[model samples]
Target: MLISVIIPCYNSEKTIAEVVSLVIEEIGKMKGYESEIILVNDFSSDNTFDVIRDLCDKYSSVKGIDLTRNFGQHNVLMTALHYTKGDIIVGMDDDLQTHPSQIPILVRKLNEGYDLVYGKYPKKKQSFFRNLGSKFNDFTVRKLLKKPKGLVASSFWAARKLVRDEVIKCKNYNVHLQGLFLRTTKRICNVDIEHRERKVGKSGYTLRKLLRLWASCINFSIVPLRLSMLVGFIFASLGIISSLIIVIRKLVFNNIYLGWSSIMAALFLFFGVVLMVLGLIGEYIGRIFLCINNQPQFVIREMINVEEE
Candidate 1:
């Protein structure tokens, strides 16, 4: 069986070569299993692609792709999936955090009749803010994507080629791999693994980028839009109830006065809710517009040791 390992490289020129070597070494230890490495450089501002090219030259089974721009990690993964030719596909990070040593655990779990296997960290080795962001993302996926309970999803995961084929069918501008995975199959399991500390630069994800990635979940679910409607209904009911109370008080006590501050506060609260709901609706429409315009998920700049089909 051939196992293809897909990695999305950012500015990881320092760590990628070692990562590839370790991946090769680990797969070499697996009996009856061959290995292929697919590295997609997500338009890193460093010499990341050059390192990937060198690895491709050194290893016959290694493939490299260069993106025209930084198309986010998930998009880059989708691009790599198009060129994968392995029976099983494994995805890991460019940074050593997802560690190559844990690949066998996911692959072994996958052989247990599961379509997908995620390498869940027993204890993540990320900063406080990154952990917080991950928690929020996990919650979002569980609720919005209908992810199976207790099935943890992470960067380090293995899936069958059928799952990969289904995932790559998603041509939307926004790519959320977990959502796509859940949509593809429910035969998913998680294996506990160690998340190593980063020995190179910090994470490429910023606060803004994290939020944008979270927003991509909208492509797979309408829960956010439904929540917006629910919130609007609740606020509208509150407005009606408050107005009734004010009218009753005015009728019962003629000397009672409605303060300008209270009226302004009510107006501000209702208007804020109204604008928020509008903005959420606008976001949905904007994404639809982009999809309808045929937005490209990713544009490949170059490829090494990969053939276009």
Candidate 2:
């Protein structure tokens, strides 16, 4: 069986070569399994692609892709999935955090009749902020994307070819791999693994990028829109009830004072809720417009050791 390992490279010129070497070494020990490495340079502002090209030249099974722009990691992964020819697909980070040594554990777990296997870290080796962002992301995935409770999701994961085929069918510009995987199959499992410290630069995800990724959850579910509707209904019900109470107070106690200040406050509160609901609706519409316009999920700048399809 052929196992394809996909890594989305950012500013990782210092560590990608060693990552490829270790992956090759690990797969070399699996007697019946061969390996193919797919390195995607996500428009890194460094010599990351150069290193990828060199790795492609050195290994016959290695392929490199250069994106026209820094499509997010999930988009780059989607692009790489299009070119994989392996029976099993594995995704890991360009940084050594998702270490190559743990690849076998994910692959072995994948072989246990599971469509997808995620390498969940027993203890993540990320900064406090990054870990916090990860927790937020995990919570959102479980609630919005309907991921199975207690099933951890991470960058290091392995999946069958069928899962890859199903996932690549998603042409939405907002590519959330966890959401996509949840939509594809429920046969997902997690294997505990060690998360190594970064050997190069820090993570590419900033606060803004993390929030943008969280917003991408809208692509897979309408829970947000539903929540907006629910909120509107609750507020409307409160408004009606409050109106009735005011009427009763005014009729029974003619001296009851409904202050202008309270009226202004209620107006401000309701208007704020209305504007927020409108903004959420606009977001949904904007994404639909982009998709209807056939926006490209990713544009490939170049390829090395990759066959023309």
Candidate 3:
């Protein structure tokens, strides 16, 4: 079984080189399965590409993929998955937080017949709000996608090559990797592993970005959409009931009075609800347009100094 260790890099210069070295040193102990380390530089404005190139020159099994621009961590991982030629593939971030030492644990779990083995953290050492928000996202994902109730970290996981292929074939291009795992594979297990705070540099995921991810997770659910339709129906019903009350008040009870403020307020509230529904519809439409475009998830503008043996 060939093992491909795929790490996606985006300006991870501070700690990236150490991660590469650690994976190379640790994976060298495993026998029979040839190992390949694929580092994809996501157009790092820093010296990320240069570091990858240097590593490639130093190690025969090390390879580098240079994307044209930053296509996000998930997109680059998928791109590497497309190019992976391994019996079993392991994926992780270039950040040191997802330790390379745990790769063997995940791979061993995969070998025990599980299609997917994720490395859940012992305790995430993120800021309070980040941790809280991430937990909320995970909660919604579990409720909506019916994914396993595992403490899933977006950091490390291993899967059989077939699982990789199935996930890649998914049509949804928003590219939530863990969700794709749930969507494609039935045999999934998460093992508790070491989780370290970032040794250097701030996290790429900000509060806004986490919330956006939360939105995507919820957006993918039928329940939110069903709820939207339910709310719309309620709103429509309310509008009808309100109009009836106004007419009855004026014609039968003579209690209707002209108050421009109330009328304008109702109009604004109704229109606001309409606009919100439209916004949700627009999000789905935008995703559809992106798929129709069928653009490459990550464009490798150039590969640098690649050599085997």
Number of the top-ranking candidate, with TM-score as the measure: 1
Candidate 2 vs. true structure, TM-score: 0.97
Candidate no. 1 TM-score: 0.98
Query: What C-alpha RMSD separates each model from the true structure?
Result: 0.9, 1.1, 2.9
lDDT, model 1, position 126? 82
Residues 1-309, candidate 1, lDDT per residue (tens digit)?
Answer: 999999999999999999999999999999999999999999899999989999999999999999999899999999999999999999999889999998889888999999999998989988887888888888878999898777778889999999998999888989988889988899999899999999998999988998988889888899988999999899889889988998999999999998999989988998998899899899989999999999999999899999889
Between 1 and 3, whose TM-score is larger?
A: 1
Candidate 2 local lDDT, 1-309, one digit each (tens)? 999999999999999999999999999998799999999999999999999888888999999999999889889999999999999999999888888898889888988899999998989887887888788888877889888989989889999999999999898887888888998999999999999988877878888988897888889899999999999999999999999999998999999888999999999999999999999999999999999998888999899999999
- Candidate 2 — number of clashing residue pairs? 0
**Alpha-carbon error at 302 in model 2, in Å?**
1.0
Model 3 lDDT per residue over 165-273, tens place = 8977865557777677777778888888888878888877766666665666543567766767998899999999988888887898776586999989989998998
Quote the RMSD, in angstroms, for model 1: 0.9
